[model samples]
Target: MCRLTRLVACLLTLLFLVSCSSHSTQREAQPGLFLSSNNLPVFMSSPQVSFVLITKIQVPVQEGFDQEARLRNTLAVLTEMAAEVGANAIIVTNAEEFAAAYNRVSTGTHFLAGASFDLSPDAFKHVQLKAQAIYLNR
Candidate 1:
């Protein structure tokens, strides 16, 4: 009899916690910005004749719980940037040291439910990526 009472109490507590999750109270994750532009401005690290126009760049993006999805989006942006410059090589100068946070949002439909979500920071997180890359003209 005591065990049953304890179980009931635990279940009720769990339900209460889930229901009390107000939107304002929920922790928001920082969002990654990708593909802001294809042809990012390039600055040469050295002064050389017809220097390979590469930029020391930083992409301050990627935040959320969905790591795989965020990584995919980030990679796509970098690829487009590379292609735009007709570059054949990229080297990392620096990488960010944090994982962006995100949450799952769900919507319901008649006899079914659907949902989609993205990285959006409720509380802003400062993140940056830096790279010194050399792009060989293709």
Candidate 2:
């Protein structure tokens, strides 16, 4: 009974880590200017080049629990995504961190249901990043 319980505990830990993994989606490429939100207006309003929308990016952040890692990862992911889409710059429209209890035991149909029951804080926190993927006009 003791050995069986230990095995079960290990399996549960593995499952939880797997379920909390991060995910990212990439879009097609284009040529353009790459500008952060702070530098947007200067480059965007310039007559020499125009800002074009390549795609919007949304990704689940993994190191959200750690402040330093979260910040680094956020910037890295955005830069990577922009490069993937051949974007010279990325304008982050919204960046936020949120926590919510999620139900992880449901079937495919109801994968994410609001947590009605009390749950541990560590199990429900998540970070999400949303950005406007843009390219510069040649």
Candidate 3:
């Protein structure tokens, strides 16, 4: 009980510190309110085609990471991302080694981890890439 409490407190402190010292980036909090006019190729509506979610959340190895837990988190993030993009099915998605080099000092061990995802359609017609929920290209 005490250990759990300490861990929670530690996490809260870490979060507070991070929030206070986070690098700022400009993005509208609510996305998908309206069509974006970035002049990029994008589909307007959800399609019957499948999708794949790709995420590359890499971290330094100072904090120990369980491979199983990392995989689960990555999968969850992917699922949520896919769902947001009007996609229900995913294919050809996987994580690969980005880089891992660490030094084990007298204090602790450090390492690195990286992941990725790639999405593509099974087939398409007259469309570029036919991905990201491309429809009617069977």
Per-residue lDDT of candidate 3, residues 1-138 (tens digit): 999999999999999998863122222122232222232233334445543332212222222254344344434443344334433333321122212212122112332233112211211111111113111223
Over 4 Å off, model 1: 1-53, 62-65, 96-125, 136-138
Q: Best candidate per TM-score, number?
A: 2
Query: Per-residue CA lDDT of candidate 1, range 21-66, in tens?
Result: 3221111222123323344333324323332534434453454445
- Higher-lDDT candidate among 1 and 2? 2
TM-scores vs. true structure, each candidate: 0.36, 0.46, 0.27
lDDT minimum window of 10 residues, candidate 3 = 122-131
On the 0 to 100 scale, the lDDT of residue 122 in model 1 is: 25
lDDT of 2 at 70: 58
Top candidate, metric lDDT: 2
What TM-score does candidate 1 get on C-alpha atoms? 0.36
lDDT, residue 43, model 3: 37
Error of 1 at 82 (Å): 2.7
Candidate 3 regions exceeding 4 Å error are 1-65, 92-94, 98-138
Weakest ten-residue segment in model 2 by summed lDDT: 99-108
Ranking by TM-score: 2, 1, 3
Q: Can you write out model 2's per-residue Cα lDDT over 27-136, one digit (the tens) per residue?
A: 65564544443333312122455767777676554354554565556667766766655666666655422222112321122233564444333332344666666676
- Inter-residue clash pairs, candidate 2: 32-135, 32-136, 33-136, 34-88, 34-89, 35-89
